[model samples]
Target chain A: MSDSTLTVERVSLRIGTFALQDISFSLAPGQVYGILGPSGAGKSVLLETIAGFYWPDHGRILIEGRDVTRAAPEARRVGFMFQDYALFPHLTVAQNVKFGLQFRRSRPRPTEHSQVQDLLARLGLEQIAERHPSNLSGGEKQRVALARALAMEPAFFLFDEPLSALDARTRDSLREELRTLLRELGVPAIYVTHDQTEALVLADRLAVIRDGVLLQEGTPSEVFGAPVDEFVARFVGVETIIAGRVLCTHDGVATVQVTPERRIEAVDHGAVRSPSVLVCIRPEDVALNRPPAKDSAGANQFPGRVVGGEPLGPMLKVKLDCGFPLTAFVTKRTYLDLKLAPGAEVVAHIEAAAVHLIGQP
Target chain B: MRTQTLGQSRGLVFVFSVVGGLLLAFILVPLLRMYATQTPATLMQIAAIEDVQSAIWLSLEAAFLTALLAGALGVPLAYLLARTTFPGKGVVEAVVDLPLAIPHTVVGIALLFVFGRTGIIGGPVNAVTGFQFWGTWGGIVIAMLFVSVTYTVNAARVGFESVDARLERVARTLGAGPWSVFGRVTLPLAWRGIVTGLMLTYARSISEFGAVIILTYYPMTAPVKIYDLFLQSGLDESSAMAVLFLTASLAVFIILRHLSYGRVTPGGRRM
Candidate 1:
C-alpha cells in the first residue's frame, strides 16, 4: 500500500481514429491528478488504459514499479469508478461493499466489517448501506461507488468524470468530499474529466490532455497562471495574454512593460531572463479604475479607455481598449458609482502577483 | 383541413378495426379450442389417468432439466460472447442459433447419431454409465435440451449483451473478479431476460413433439402422449389431453409472466 505509485510511460493506444499517443504521467501516493480535456480528447481512454480495461498498443503502465500493462483489471488491483457509477443493481449497499471482499475469501481478514462500516459512515452512506443503488440519488450513488472502490482498498484509484453526472451544486460539494476522502485514503487517484472547473477544484495537480497527448501538467495555480501554450491557457480560463517585455528586475521581481503605456509587474526568478516576455493575467483579476490611481496596494495602474461594458447579473464586465484590450470584472454598483461608459477614460490597475510571467509566445 | 383530417382519422379507425379484429381472431381461435370442452369435469377426469399423470410429470421433468441445462451452459458462453473480442464471434453465434433454423427432425436425427446405442460416443458412454438413450428418459432430455436450450441461450445472450461491459469492468476494479462481478452485477441486471428465456425454453420443450417422438417414443411426454391418444384412443381423448395441457401451459405462462413482470427489482423498487 505504501509503495503504490502508478506511472504511465509513453503509453499509446489506437482505437480506430481515436487514440492516446505517447501519453505519460505518474501518480504519486495520495495525490489527486486530474486529466482534463475536451470531449473526444481520449481522457477516458487513458483512464481505461490505466485501469487495465484497454491494453495500450505501445509503451507500459507500471503500478508500484511493476509493469501491469498486460494485467487483467482485477490483477492490477486498480480501482476504476465509472462516470455512471456502475453499481450492482442486485446487491444492497452493504452487499455491494462486500462484493470485493468475497473475491479475497481464501484468506479472510479480520478488518472487513470495521473497514466497511467506517467507509460507509465516512461517505455518509451508513443508512443507505442496507439500501440499493437504484434507491439513491446521483450524488449518493457516486459516494456508494467510491465507497465500494475504496472498500477493496486497491493500490490506486481511477475516476472517470465522477462529478459530471451531478448537478452544479452537488458537484461542488461532492468535489470537496472526494478531495477529503482521497487525502484520507492516501492512494493516488487519476481523475478524468472534461469540465474545467471540476478538474481545477478536485485535482492537486491538473494535466491538460487533448487528442490523447499530455499537453501540460502542474499544480492548479501554476498551470492556470502560466500555461505553456495558448490552447492550455484558454483551457485554464485565462483569456487575456499580453505580449510584454522585461523592462527591469528589482527585488526578485520583473517589471514587464507592455503596450505604449501600461507597466505590468510579475515575479521574476531564474526564468525571467530576457527583455521580451509574455505577461499573462486573468480577466477577473484585472481592475478598472475611474481615475488613474498612481499608487495602490501591490497594484500597477495603466491608462486605458472603456470600449464597452457587458452587464452580467450583479457584475459588470468592462472591456478596456488598451494595447491588449483587457477585460475587467467589477460590481454593477461600482460601475454605476464610477459612471463608467464607453469612450470614458479609465485606469487598468493590475496587481504584481496577479500578473503572470509566462514564456515568450 | 381539420374536418378532412378528422374524416381521414375515422376512415383509418375503421380500417384498423377490421385488420386488428382479424389478427386477434387468428391468435385467439386455437386458444379458444384448447380450453373449450364438453364439460369442465371431463378435462379433470382425463387428467386423472395414470398414463396422463406420467406424461405430465415427464414433461415437467424434461422441461425443467432442459432449462437448468441451458442456464448452466448458456450464461458463461453468453458472457464470453458478450464481453470479449475474439475471432469468429459471428460464426459462433450462427452455430449456436443453427438449431432454430434446422428442422426438429434433423435435430432428432443429430441427437440420435450422437446419443444412440450404436452411435459415436454413445457406445463407450453407455458401457461406462450403463445408460441407454435411444428410448430412455435421457434421450428425451437430450432432445428437449437440443431445441429448448437454444431459445434460452440466444435470449440470455441478448440479455447479457444488454448489460454494459463497462459495468462489469468497473466491478472488477472495485475488487470483483470475473465470477463475483458476473454474479453480483451482470447476473442481476440480466436476470429478467434470462428468466424469460428459461421460461420460453421450458414452454417450448414441454410442447415439443417431433424431436421427442423421434428420439424417445417409449417415455411419452405430454405432447407425445397427446399425439398417441389422437392415434390410438380417438379425437375425444386427444381433446381431453389438449385441454389438460392447455391448463398446465397457461398456468406456467401466468407464473413466468408474474415472475418477470410482477414488480420492479428490489434495487429499482427502492427508487
Candidate 2:
C-alpha cells in the first residue's frame, strides 16, 4: 500500500538455537498490527528488528518506502516502548520525555516545550512530570513512557508487551487508553503481546506466531472466526480443537469423522483431502439447548451430556461430551434459565459454516 | 515460644556483639589512638611542615589522577564485560579481579617486572621517555592504579549491568546514536554505581603504601612518608604525621562520600 508506514520484507534472524524464519508484514498508516504468540515466539525479536535493535540476517525493512534495513535505529525514525517502561530511572518524567528531543538533529521549534507539555497533559502525566519513574504507579509509568516515545514523533511505533507488566485491572484500563492513544496518533504501530484479547482489542490486524514462524495473519474476526491451523485456532480462543479423519468430501463439503459415531460437516477450504485434519470450533459459535424438538433434526446436531459448567463473568462456559468433548459459552441469564448442570442432557448444534477444517500438521 | 526466640536472639546479639565489636575495635582503635596522640597544636604544626604538606598534596593528586585514568580505561572494559559474552569472559573477569586477590606487595613486584626499568616494556619505555617508572610520580600513580583499578572496573560493571539494555534500544529507536544512548541513558542510569566505584578507587589509591614504596618511594605519598618518618624518628613525630594525613584524607573522603551518596537532588542532576 502507498500509505504503508512500515514494511518488513522476508526478515529472518538466527540467534543461537532459535531462528525467526522469513517474517514479512506491512502496516499502513493508522494501523495497529498485533503479533500474538506464546512467550518464546520471537515476537520481541521481530519488534526489535523493526526498531533497528537487531539486524535481520536475510531481509529488508522499509519505513515509509525507504530501505532502512542497514540504517541505525536513530536514523530509522522509530520509537520503541519497552515492557518495563524503561523510563530512564535517573530522569524525572519531564526529563525522560525531553531525552529524545535533545538528541534529535532538528533545531528546537518554538512549540517544543509546549508540545512536550501537551503530550504530558494529554496522557494525564502533568502532575508527575517532576517525579522520577520510581515514584510513579504502573499505569503512570506506562503513560510517561508513551509520552516520552511520542515526543520523538517518529514514523512508527513498536511496543513490546506494553500492558503486560501492569496488574489486571490497570492493564484493562490502560489497554483502552493505549488503543485510543494509538488511534489518535494515527501512525502505524506494531503491538507485541502473548494475550489474545489484547491483540484482538488493540490491533486492526493480527499475526499469530509460534516457534519463531509466522503461523497466520488476518483481521481479529477472521483469525478468531476461522484460524488457518490448529495452533492458531487454539491460540485465538477456539476452546474445542478436534483431530479428525476426513471421511469423505461430498459437493465441496467434507465430513470429518472425529470419532466412530461423531462426524462433523464443514465446508472444505481446499485442504479436506488430507488424511487427517483438525476441526476447530469456537465456543461462542456452538449453540446449546436443553433438548432439540423432533422437527429440529440436523446432520450437525448431537445429544451430549454436560460434563462441566463454569461461570465466566456474565458467560457460563459449559463442557459437553458428544462422543468427543465440545465447549460452549452461553449467556449467564440463559444458562441459569436452562437449569444446566453437570449430569444434564443437552443438544449441541454446530452450523456447517462455523466448523473450520485445518490440515493436521 | 516468644521468650525462647527472645532469649535466643539475645544470645545471638551477645555473640554478634562480641565478634563484630572486636573487629570494629581492632580497626577503630589504631586510627583513634593515632588521632588522640596528636593535639590540634601538633596536628597544625605537622600540617605546616613542607614535607608533610607536600606529601599530603602529592597523595591527593596521585589518587585523583589514578581514579581519572582508571575510570577512562576501566569503564568501557566494564561495560564490555557486563554486556557481551565472549570466549574467555570468565577468565577476563577473574583477571580484572586478580589485583584484589593478590598481595599488595606482589602487585608492586608484578608492576616492577613489567613497568620497572630493565624489565619487559620498561627498558624501551625508559629509553623513549628518558625516565623510568621508578622514582617518578607516574610510577606512584601506576602503582596505586594497579592495586585499586579493580574496584572501579567491578563497580562500573555492576552499574552497567544494572542499566537495562532495553532502555538503550528504546533510546536508539528514539533517534539516539549509540554514543548518545550510552551518554544519555546508560551512563546517567549507571552513574551512581560508577561514582561509587571511582570513590572506592580514590580511597584505595590514596591509602596505597606498599606498592607506591616499591615502585617510587622518592616522591613519597602520605603513607610512604608516614612510614619513612616512623623509621627515622619514632612514634610522636610519625604519629603526628599519621594523625594529620588521616584527618585530612578522612575529611576529604567524608565530604566526597557525602556529596556523592548524600541527598542526590531530584533528577539526580548533581550526580
Candidate 3:
C-alpha cells in the first residue's frame, strides 16, 4: 500500500450486543470503499471505530502508515460527515466552514480565508454564507457539511448515510454530485449506506456487512454479479435465488436440477465442490419469450406462467412460476407487446453465464 | 363525530381558561393590592433609605455570586449527567434536586450544619484564614445557593442534552480537542439552557428568606430586612420597602429576559 493508504487490520469490536468480527479492509488514495449493510448491522459502529470514536478490542487502524488506534479523533485527521449532516445550528455557513481552520497546528496558510470562500462558492453556498443551518434546506445542509469537512483537508473521510435524510429527488441528484466531488478531491473515503444504488454508484470497492460480520468484499460489479452467499445474492438485487443440486458438469458449465423436472445450466467456476447449490439469477438477466408448442426445452429454458407483476418505472418486475418461483425484469414495452399478464404462459431463458452458483452451506 | 370532538375540546378549553385566569388573578391581585397601598412618595422614601438600599444591594450581590458559583460548579456535573451513563446516576440526580423537595428552613438548617462557624468545612477554613460564615456574606451566598442551585444544574443538563453528540464528534474530527469542542460547539449550543437556569437560580436566590434569615440575619437581604421592618414597625412602613424591592427585582428580571430574547431572535425568527 502507498503511504496515503488507510488500512484496518483484523479489527474486531463489540458494542453492546453487536460485534464486528475480524473485519479488515484497505483503501488507496482516490478509492471509495463503500460499506453496505442493513440497519443495525454495525456499519456505523465500524465507521465510528475507525474514526477513533470507539476503540477496537483486537486491531490496529493505520492511517498514512501511522497507527491511530489510540489517538484522539482530533489527532487522527479523519473527516466524518454524519447521517444527519450535523451542521452546527449556531454558526453561519461561512463560520461552520471556517471552524476547523483555527485548530490547525501548522502555520496558517495565507489563502485560508479565500480557500474557504472558494469551497463555499464551489458548493454554491456563497450566497447563503451568513445563514444558519436551520434556515437552509436539506440539500444545502449537505453541501455545507461537505464544505466544512473538506475545509479541514483531512487525509481520509468517513460518511455515514450522508444522503439518507434527504428526499428521494434531492438524494438522487446529490448522489451524483457527491460521486463527482469525491472523485475530484481524490481522497480515500469510506461511504457507509444501506442503499444498494448508492453503493453501486459510489463505491470503487464494496464490502457487504451483516450482523457485524464482513460477508464479502470486492469491486461493485464483482460483488454484485458474483455474490458469495444467498444473503448477498438477495441483498445485491438478485431477485431469484433457489436451491438446486448439481447433476452433471461439463466444460466449466454444470446442469443443476432445481426440481425433479426442472433444470438450470450455470458456469461452475470450479467453486462448487458439493452437489447441493444455490442458483442465483438477477431479474434483468432472465429473458421472457413465447412458450413453444412442442415440449422441446432448451438447455436453460423453462415454460412457466406469469403469476403477477408490477410496473417499476419503465420496467416491469415480473413473477413467474417456472416449476419454481422466478422473478424477471422486462421492459414495459416488452410486457405490452407480449400481452403478458397474470396466468399468461411464457418461457424464461437464463444463460449459463448469467447464472451464479454458490455452494450450499 | 369530529364535530362532537371539536365541541368537547372547546368545552375543555373554556374550563381551562376559567381556572387558569382565576389562578393568574390570585397571584397578581395580592401584589397589585400591596402596590396600590404604596404611593410614589412613600416608595421613593423607602428606596432612599440607606439601610434599604444596602440590604437590596446585598441581596443582588449575594444572588449574583451564588449564580456564578453554581454555574462554575454545576455545568460539568450537568454535562456528565446529560452525556454519560453510570452506576448511581439516579442517586446523584436526586441529591441535586433534594433542596427543591425539602422545606427552605430545613435546607437552611442542613446548610448550617456544614457551613456554620464551628462546622466541619467552616471551622478549618476559619482557623486558617480567620474568616467565618456566621453572619457573613459567605453565609448568605451559601444559604441562597443551597436552595437555588438545583435550577442551574437541571436547566444546564437539559440544555446539554438538547445538543447533538454527533456535532461534538464532528468537531473532534475537524481537529478540535475536547475542550475546544466543548467551547466552540457544545457550550454555544447549550448556552440558552444554561442561561435560563442561571436566571432562575438568581431569581430564586434573591427571594430566599427562610434560609438567609437562619444563616445570616445581621447582614440582611431584602427579604429578611422587609420581614424585620414588618415585625419592628407596621405593614404600612414595610409595604413601601416591599414595593421598592419588588419593583427593582421585576425590572432586573425583565431586562435580563428582554436582552436574552432580543439576541435569540435576531431576524425575528422564533428558534
Supply DockQ values for each candidate: 0.49, 0.58, 0.61
What digit string (tens of lDDT, one per residue) describes model 1 on residues A1-361? 3254888889999999988889877888878888888888998888888887889999988999888889988888777888768887777888777667656755457777887888889888988888877778876887788788777778888888877877778878878877877787687888988887778877888899998889998898888877877788878877577788787888877887786676777876556656777777787787776775656444467777888888765678888877667888888877887778898887787767777776663
- Model 2 C-alpha lDDT per residue in residues B1-271, reported as the tens digit of each score: 2434533677777788789989999999988877766788877777788999999989988998999999999999999998899999999999999898888888888888888888787788889888788888889999999999999999999999988888888888777888988888788777777888999999999999888888787888899999988899878888999888887888888888888766453355453
Lowest-sum lDDT 10-residue window in model 1 chain B? B262-271
Q: Considering TM-score, which of the candidate structures 1 and 3 is the better prediction for this target?
A: 3
Per-residue error (Å), model 2, residue A216: 1.1
Q: Which sections of candidate 3 miss by over 4 Å?
A: A1-4, A109-111, A293-297, B1-8, B264-271
Best by TM-score: 3
Report lDDT per candidate: 0.80, 0.86, 0.89
DockQ leader: 3
Which 10-residue window in model 3 chain B sums to the lowest lDDT? B262-271
Residue-wise lDDT of candidate 3 within A107-181, one digit each (tens)? 467768898899998889989998988888877887898889888888888999988978888899889888888
Top candidate on lDDT is: 3
lDDT by residue (tens digit), candidate 1, B1-271:
3434534687777788799999999999977976675476777788789999899888887788888898898878877777777999999988888878878888888888888878787778899988888778888988888887778877887888888777788777866677777777788788777887888888888888888788889888988999899999988888888878767777877876686766456356721
Candidates' TM-scores?
A: 0.84, 0.91, 0.96
When only chain A is evaluated, what TM-score does every model earn? Answer: 0.86, 0.92, 0.95
Interface RMSD of 2: 2.5
- Which of the CAPRI classes, incorrect, acceptable, medium or high, describes model 2? medium
